[model samples]
Target: MATDELPDRIAEIFNGSTIFITGASGFVGKALIEKLLRLTNLRKIYLLLREKKGKAPVDRMQDIFNNVLYDKIKSLKPHALSKCTAIQGDVSQINLGISQEDREKLKNEVDFIFHSAATTRFDDTLKYAVIMNTRGTMYMLRLAEECKKLKLFVHVSTAYAFPREKILYEKAYEPIADPQQVLSSLNWIKDEAMQEMQDKILGDIPNAYTFSKSLAEALVYEKAGKIPVIIGRPAVASFKLTSSEFINHELATEHVRPSPFAMMDCRLPVFVTFCLLRYPQLKCLSLCLRMHIEIY
Candidate 1:
């Protein structure tokens, strides 16, 4: 579609809007940033990035855009890259470890927020997972409450957060434990003690990832007072590699395994639809999962 022929409704909603995104370097976050730049007339995108391996946030941001994922934007709309700015921060830290100037700027100018940063490792320690997923959500919610122009706060959660339910619904489920109490315990409980009680704390949730995500959802339900919130529960998302040549070469020596459950295509449309649409009554959005015969 021609730029002039872009849909008016989407354009009207996003034109000149300023967005703040955590986990901008992750799979979903990168895809969402690409879509916003390629499809919307948004004015700015602030990415929260932390230093790693001696590289500054700006350097990491450059590395992300250099990936093959941003090739289309580079050729078609290179100027869009200029709108993205990296703010130094870590979600696991208090105040997100963001500078006061940057925090104030976000509070004054940001219109939308996408909190997608979390430790996704299934084997991660319960303490680290809670700090990253549960308490990190609390900090984001507090910041969302202070945003002067905030219109929406989208929290990216997992479909399997409540795994005990055979059929998951598009609504919040009771967390395994109170999020506040969980956070408090982390302060006094030793790592060995937490590890010993892991089975009891997780119950049937499976791992730290899902268990922390469940608590995050509960925290959002309890604290998101007046703020417009949407909890997106996306199920096992993966890319379907269509190029035969790339696949053959890439898999020549690699072992590929089939995903146990149905997968959802991790595409721009999935994120864009839920993030940009102004549906006040739509509190929870769950992506429909479909079976894919191809093994990755």
Candidate 2:
């Protein structure tokens, strides 16, 4: 396919597909939704979001529609708003904390799932990380299996899942700790005990975020033969040429790591991996960039 025909070809697969996206309120998740809603006219996008502090998912999504980023969506297809639906759910909980009715609605109809909800905090305790990142993924996999019409389970993982080794490549890596052991122990470990074991548990791995993500990837890999799943290990995310928001340096700065030697003016690169047999059309990009940098 010609380079110009690539996007359209990639979009064809999702033209009528039903997509369930977790962590839709997150930075990457939001961008994924914007592209889907604007480009392909996806059949339905079930947004799995935790009811924030007090607001319901619908209210939160409405607020999203009002944001400047969605101005293009509004102008393009004002009536297409009905194609989107927000459901209250938590990634770390069984059935995503959705009611039986809502769970059925998704399991029976959704075709693809993008799992992105994660506790990205570096200092998160092993217990919380296991619950949210490791166990949470197990639950998502179970849910994906229930989707009779499901075609793909796209998991958003981190490149640092392997840590800053001398060299990193486009292949799967194993986790340091026993994921099953850590998951089983989560129920019994107190918050304070987990906190104490943080350094010891993660070991050579950088932090709880990376450790949990690594464990989660292991879980997804272990189930590979039985399911159609793809793990996307993304590095740091920043502005893309097609992104709606003007490269907002201030907003993007918080996500970048802070280092004394880091350059402030370099662009990041992303590498994305996919299962060609399953999702032949879509393009995946894995992003890697400095922690502290200004984007133009």
Candidate 3:
């Protein structure tokens, strides 16, 4: 019998490490949790979940496991999931809205931190965007700095964070605005005025989310000294996800939306996924989700 090779990147980082993750409920976040549980023997995954809809964080974590994403893991390493614990907190609040005890615990015990919690809403107001994307980053940075044995702080940003440049490369640039200054100005700038000036403020950037992400990138880049920080910009594109395609093992590589490309299949015999990292001459940035698919 032959077996597919495990993704070494997953094991090299997550194996036997206590990971503190912020966005466990998001699409990418859930997939990450599944991959970690499936591919490696991790120590623990601390999900920073806030009590919402009158439900506890642990209860919500259970609902997350209920998703089909965890089906295989639920069967294979049934006890592997026992490593995951819920840390009640919100990213949009002070100190990620975590209790002092939990914060100190993470600072002491956690080895890896993944911050994927951000509002990707294009139409969100500048006020809210700054708080969620920009300020939320600062809060995570503060916590990352305090970790005694933190190895890496992986921040999930967007390729569109720098929309001004057509040929975007991997490098940190000067921030549009100081995050601290943006936080202070949020106190005084009325939402109405902010809306009016939003276009001018973002300049070539399209939405408030990207603009705030650009600012967040700068904040993360500056703190590279305290911790080994990586700003992961996923140019993940949306597919024409038809109902039938979702069930059957079929993939369409049609140039959907002229930018991002996503291929879907029922299963992958061997997970060999390749990413299309080319954005030649288009204003539309693509989000590529390379998934393992079985050819029927």
* lDDT comparison, 2 vs 3, better candidate: 3
- lDDT computed for candidate 3: 0.72
How does residue 26 of candidate 2 score in lDDT? 69
Order the numbered candidates by lDDT, best leading.
1, 3, 2
- Is 2 or 3 the stronger prediction by TM-score? 2
Write the residue-wise lDDT of candidate 2 on 1-296 in tens digits: 88875665546767798998887776666666766777675798898877787998899988766655566667887876688899888977765698889889988999888888899998877777878998989999988988999877778887788775556665566676789898878778888887887888777787788888888988887767666777776676544232224434324776763321111221111112224334444333233333222321
Candidate 2: misplaced stretches above 4 Å?
1-7, 240-296
- The TM-score between candidate 2 and the true structure equals 0.81
lDDT accuracy of residue 144 in candidate 2: 90
Can you write out model 1's per-residue Cα lDDT over 71-171, one digit (the tens) per residue? 77788898999999999999999879999999999999999898999999999989999999999999999999999998778888888788888998766
lDDT of 3 by residue, 171-289 (tens): 67666667778889888999899889888877777788988998998888877665666666667533334445433533354443321122222111111111111221221122322
Cα lDDT, model 2, residue 72: 66
Candidate 2 clashing pairs, residues 3+ apart or interchain: 256-291, 257-291, 270-286, 270-287, 271-286, 272-286
Candidate 3, after superposition: displacement of residue 218 in Å?
0.2
lDDT for 238 (candidate 1)? 58
Rank by TM-score (best first): 1, 2, 3
